[model samples]
Target: MSAPLGVIVAVRGEAEAAVVAEVDAHPRLTVVRRCADLAEAVAVARAGLGAVVVLSAQPHLDADAVAAIRAAGAGIVGVGGGPGSRLEALGIAVARSALAEAVLAAVSGPAPEFVAPPERGTAAMVAVWGSGGAPGRTTVAVNLAAEAALAGHRTILVDLDTYGASVATALGLADEAPGIAAAARAAARGEDAGALLDRHALEVAPRLRVLTGLTRAARWPEVTAPGLERLWPALRAAADVVVLDLAAPADAGASPQGPGPRRDGATLAGLAEADVVIAVGGAEPHQLVRLVHVLLDHDGPTPVVAVNRIRAAVAGPRPEDAIAAALGRHAGVTEVWPLPWDLRACDAAARDGRTLAEAAPRSPLRRAIASMAEVVVAAARAARDAPATVTD
Candidate 1:
């Protein structure tokens, strides 16, 4: 004879007694345990005491519990629920009257087996960084995000600058409570991993959303790696591309003795996770010097440089060619994208709270940014497809 089906009952209110009786009366089903709550039911399943949990559909029977039940290697027949309940996805939703048949049938079949979800590639993380003195990291990040979106990719502009985020101001988004800072704080407190994308992401354009940064500079420490560790996966899952606007690189060059100097947790995390890094720098000599030093100092991935605000006055004649030559010779950088000065377009967008693509698509600066987005996308794809290098 076939082995009796090991079942457990976890229900409340009127459905409780009926479910227990039904399982008890069924010849093929055996009451392995009657759990007081979902936690105990999950525990019982984890301990191999129950192979099936007859769970009640109540307000407290949340998706998390059902998932726990499934993850614990137990199939569940949800009772006391109707057509539009959360437990319907479990594929065993039943009313109190149908509880006996549902439980017996679910248990009669082979026990639920854990199946790994199929893997799908997400949009690569692109870090837009700048050396200090306002190299326009926000401008680069926001435009790149918008451009990526315009290129038919879902993108999110994340302002990770703990010291005064400008994405909201740049996009004219409402300064609200659910900004990155708030999400970071909540994630630090161990909230759902997807909360970062589900609750905080704000749509600025058709395919672009922006996660505004910390409103107060004092909350810089709140954007920790631990919080972002839980957030990046969710963000990647939500968007096809993520353009992280990082603050000026500053890790104090921690020596080799210890864990080294602590960099901004978010910046460190972003750099670590990024598949492409775009280093935006000013066109002037001082900014160029700083950029050179920063690239060398940063012990992270190599970056493509974008010389922003290039003008005849600052960069001399043949500005684009000149800057490219300088960085290539001095910094050994071959890929240099020189963006022309367009103060009028930038100012207009800032004032109107719109991206350049939306406010002034015809502007040279906007066009340059769009071209750069294409380059970044190509680089990301190349990096993703490249064979992993083996080392001795």
Candidate 2:
């Protein structure tokens, strides 16, 4: 006297009876409903009318209908045969007796109650920006994403630096691909961001998907704060980590269009939403001054300052000590990391469109980047595992 398990049949004519008989053959499953078409089947499934769906593997069955049923959270089983009988590709398969036995054994045994997936809304943003010219924001972002992927996290690197979009070039990837702009447009139109993601994502690394910036700067209008906010939740739900390569707003003067107000661009939006910000700086006195000024304006979490191209022979005054002192005087930046100058390795890797780890894993600069990434990951994990508290 176990509860009945509903089944939906999606074949033409009297085949419904045959399908119901097949499903009822299993002792655990009691056929509760027989659907004439995929729409009716989907409606029944959505209303919690079935535990599993048994549908025919027919050519007439629309792919969208199958996708809709799957999205509604039902276990699907395909029967009979068709040109596209490859059910496994669509995350469904024929339920044989042996497979049913395995499933029953799993269900009957003491199993942990399934924890619902995390609520999807608002991304955990991390922005990588530099203080001045060539402080290496792209390098930090690319390496951070690679480290996250290496740890088996599905990660994405988003290039939001409208002024100089070098993420594609740095990864040795081509520019013919669509990216964040497409996602933004879809969000503006109230379209599903997941569908947009599937279209624009470029798998640069094994577990890393990169959303490159606009193909050209003129397309900046296509990306707005609201659009980004709308798309972020979906992107975050699909990725374990998101690294943003941001343009240094301090160098807005460098742009030929004349220094526009910093608050007018997407860089501000990116920083405002960032959970972690990697503020890159050089050993030069002016660079340290600019870094401090920038840090003071950052309203998000405390940023980590990465000192790039620290060369004692060229830049003078022990790089780390000088950079730390300058930051301490202005913003108390005690967590400064000095990266050794490795132009040959960085240049070679960029030229070949490969990450530093893949191109020059032994470089000191690359090691520093990896260490920085580890620190960020640890902090994020600690926050996620912390107990939730309700406050009045």
Candidate 3:
């Protein structure tokens, strides 16, 4: 038989005894290490020394600790029991019974299945985002997924914008299927997410699975960061390529300027988890500046920039050249794609609730989108092939 999986438990104060007793009772998990704080626990996990981590509910544990655990590529389970208390949303099973054997059985069970690993050399994320105005993010995402599918890649397009999601509307399937929100809710309740793919997804193109956004803004609370974390790994395993259409946040304030309580929080969480970010901006100077500021606050990977509504005869330099130059100086943006001002094509596509490829395949806009997809696919492949490394 295979050796028992090793697990690390993090506890503080009087909780240490409870966790130690649980670890001792588990037959399938050998407690390799115990830490008094999240940082110490993270250090042990990052060393590739443990298959799982159990973190006690402590006031000191925060989201950063959780991110570190995920970046280290280990499972984390949070424990909690008190008035007005809830377990932190780790993807692993939660143990409230304070029983060591029961908890160990849950944690040591078979790992959840995901979509097959991405193509051997493919990166895993392609994000489509836009500036303040409607820059056709959903349109770009839908057509891009279709293009990827046509190219023979098993593709999935996810709508992650909680407050103003429109993938269903763009596909003309509004309120027709229980899309991303349902999947997220299922994950939040610790249910199997693979079932979500079979039950909730609506097939928009051949071999392309569509994880649509919320049916309404009021449903934003159902989609949390932990729920998304659980869903995305399964999605990546199931599809050859994954495209995410994100809501454009105006700024990194307390919340996004949308019509809901948790809109901004959800958007920020989505950004943090995304592998690639596509920042879509308009031709205007102020709009480009806003995109730059948003990118700075995010302070992660630099995103591919796309300038929308380019009119050569109207005002300034070519939108692509101008935005590239400005972003290079301000946001260090080197990659930029441009979409020409094609109001007729955009309006017609929106009217029919179809993608630009279906409504206006010959439009100059299609070329830009196609080019963006090619670059995105290449980048994703490179990231996937990169070697894994330990982090502090």
Candidate 4:
């Protein structure tokens, strides 16, 4: 007779032995190995030693690890409940007697199909990120969203600066208290994020909506993946363009445990889902130096660079040329958008709680920002027209 299907069990304590016994009892399914831990199981699976693996719902078996294990060519099924969707098909109260059937089903059953509707609109995300030292990221984000709206595209601007959010203050919406933190909290509680999202996002200008940031920095923990993940997609569905003002710590890959959430987790999460990333930095020597590093560190799609607040006083007569040369040499940047030093106009808009489109339409700074917004809108539209390359 043919040998039974190979199964590796990675469950904890007595449950591990019980699973092995349960699987071995079946004539079609057999235990090939019983791993001491998740690491051993992953290593073994990576080596092509087994056909199926029953994993623990412990902290070690995360989403990335599961993807890695699957890449190694082993079929993975969850043995218990976990934080992520590692083994979503299996039930929490899965019977030991049914373990063999579940394994067989995972190996032989029809793969779960994920299909997108033909009518779903493609909403593009333009993420505005700047390294440490305020480099007008909020200004760029707000204007870009506003300008896109002026260009007749539905746009949503979000403040994701966990360190300190300036979008609300700059737009004089601090009194309204509309922001993502409360929406995130509501989303985490399993409420309809779409409804909460619309409620939190206020229309600062026609065709332009703004989702303010946290009132207090300490409340950032509420911005969990469950909520932001839901809210962002919903915003995209409602608007043609979504602009996010990101902070310096956009790549805090550190996986923190328990109560103290990673302060910049929301930024990282948002970037992961963004279609375009606009790395903004000042033209000053210090800001440029950090900007080069930040640009090089980004690992997503080719990013657009904006040398914000470029002026002769700080960066010499050819500030734009100098910034471009430095970025090209160090960070291999070929193109850059120069935002002229028009502090007075920007300050006026902030003071008036209005966007440049409304406050200073004739300003050179506004013109440059409008140009950048045009580029963003065109790119986002092009991306939308192209075949959807993303896989869930």
Across 212-261, the per-residue lDDT of candidate 3 in tens digits comes to 88888787777766567667667777788888888877454655443222
Instruction: Please give the distance, in angstroms, between residue 344's alpha carbon in candidate 4 and its true position after superposition.
Output: 1.3
Residue 358's lDDT within candidate 2 is: 91
- Candidate lDDT scores, in order, read 0.76, 0.69, 0.70, 0.76
Clashing pairs in 2: 171-353, 172-353
List the lowest-lDDT window of 10 residues for candidate 2.
109-118
Tell me the lDDT of model 3 at 206. Answer: 86
Worst 10 residues of 1 by lDDT: 111-120
Q: What is the TM-score of each predicted model, taking all chains together?
A: 0.67, 0.64, 0.68, 0.70
Backbone clashes, each candidate: 1, 2, 7, 0
Error of 4 at 239 (Å): 0.6
Ranking by TM-score: 4, 3, 1, 2
Candidate 4 residue runs with Cα over 4 Å from true position: 1-120, 175-178, 250-260, 388-392
Better of 1 and 3 by TM-score: 3
lDDT of 4 by residue, 125-235 (tens): 888986778988999998899889998988888888887888988888864585788777665443555777678888888898888998887777677554565566577
What TM-score does candidate 2 reach? 0.64
- If candidate 2 were superposed on the true structure by all CA atoms, what would the RMSD be? 13.3
Highest TM-score model number? 4
